[model samples]
Target: MLATIERVLILDRAEEISKMVLQSEIAEEYFRCIYKVKNNLETQRKIREFIKVKEQYEEVQRFGKYHPDYRVVMIKVRELKREMDLDEHVAKFRIAENELQSLLDEISVIIGHSVSEQIKVPTGNPFFDSSSNCGGGCGSGGSCGCSA
Candidate 1:
């Protein structure tokens, strides 16, 4: 009971700190601004950076989820030496491993979907105005608009 309360307090403090950092006016405005890219390569570069950071954070969460599983697996392996039914222990261990594998696959799919969505740029969006054909001279920066 005491441990649970302590954990709850810690998490509450952490969330408060996160809200302060993320909800600042400057941070909100900066993230709201549309990013301008000179070319497809530049756009891709920016997208990659965003994806990398997201993936890193997800990886940390994945590691955290597995910590308890690691302990369970260790216990099961040690129990394999006991006089209990060997088949039952083996089956249980396999089940745990399968569960872990499934979790990893789900995480991969979520990250892939998130990254793909971020990279999908709508045509004619002002963020990439140069790349969109709006009856301009030469595409901006030799991209698609020639209005430079």
Candidate 2:
């Protein structure tokens, strides 16, 4: 039930945060690594191959050991995965991507906690998994962050 002006202000602040993230060193490195992965033809080819093999492996997995080609398909998938992981640019890109994701997760956790620690924000990091703690107490403003 926010008024138009309040909604607009919130939207504006979101835009500002987006800009700040885009300018951060973590974000910059993420973009650089992603660009390298995107432009590398060998990586692109391997990615495509991996996707195809992975899908086939999934199909075989549904049948468990009964699938005649399960072992063969699984072996091929693992081999392709190793190749993909060995690529320098792909490895760097994955690291950068994970770092950026962690940064964004932290910001999300902060915003959620500010409103109320009772709010459950799912950051994949085990250290930030405060969904159960709820800070301290209910609403005495002990640590449950709600300021009312």
Candidate 3:
């Protein structure tokens, strides 16, 4: 266990590292893309529409198939999701966001491994985890020859 002074020093260094990260290329792109997404009128309108549909979808989910509008709400949610995913600004923002996540994950992995190679560091890739049953879409209900 670290002492209070040691913890405070680590936190101060962490803030410096965070500032360096925000100045990096991927982080800069992430900020820029998010700014566009927030300011674009059409995208904001579409997002508002999607939020309304999502709320309706959530309500339908509470009743499952028993809800009279279940099928239609599900379809609308999927379609809206697709449209949002296809938007150029949204797509770029998502890509930057993922890239930034990957960078942070890498940093975490380095820190964890530095402390102890046996420590568990989640990199969001099952293949990197020795305890995972299978890394081939098993989580999506597809059989990957692993007994569940």
TM-score of each: 0.22, 0.80, 0.78
Per-residue accuracy of model 2 over 1-148 as CA lDDT, tens digit each: 7579878998999899999999999999999998999999999999999999999999998999899998899999999999999999999999999999999989998888888866767676766774546432356654555432
lDDT by residue for model 3 (1-148), tens? 7579889998998899899899999999999999999999888877888999999999999999999999999999999988888888999999999999988877777777778765666678553544334442356554764443
Q: Weakest 10 consecutive residues, lDDT, candidate 2?
A: 130-139
Model 1, TM vs. native: 0.22
Identify the runs in model 2 with alpha carbons over 4 angstroms from their true place.
Answer: 131-148
- Model 1: how far residue 119 lies from native, Å: 11
**lDDT per residue, candidate 1, 57-139, as tens digits?**
45555676465455544444345333222334333444544444444444444444465633322322243323334332343
Q: Please say which candidate is ahead in TM-score: 2 or 3.
A: 2
| Model 3, TM vs. native | 0.78
Q: Model 2 Cα displacement at 17 (Å)?
A: 0.6
Which one is best on TM-score?
2
**Candidate number with greatest lDDT:** 2
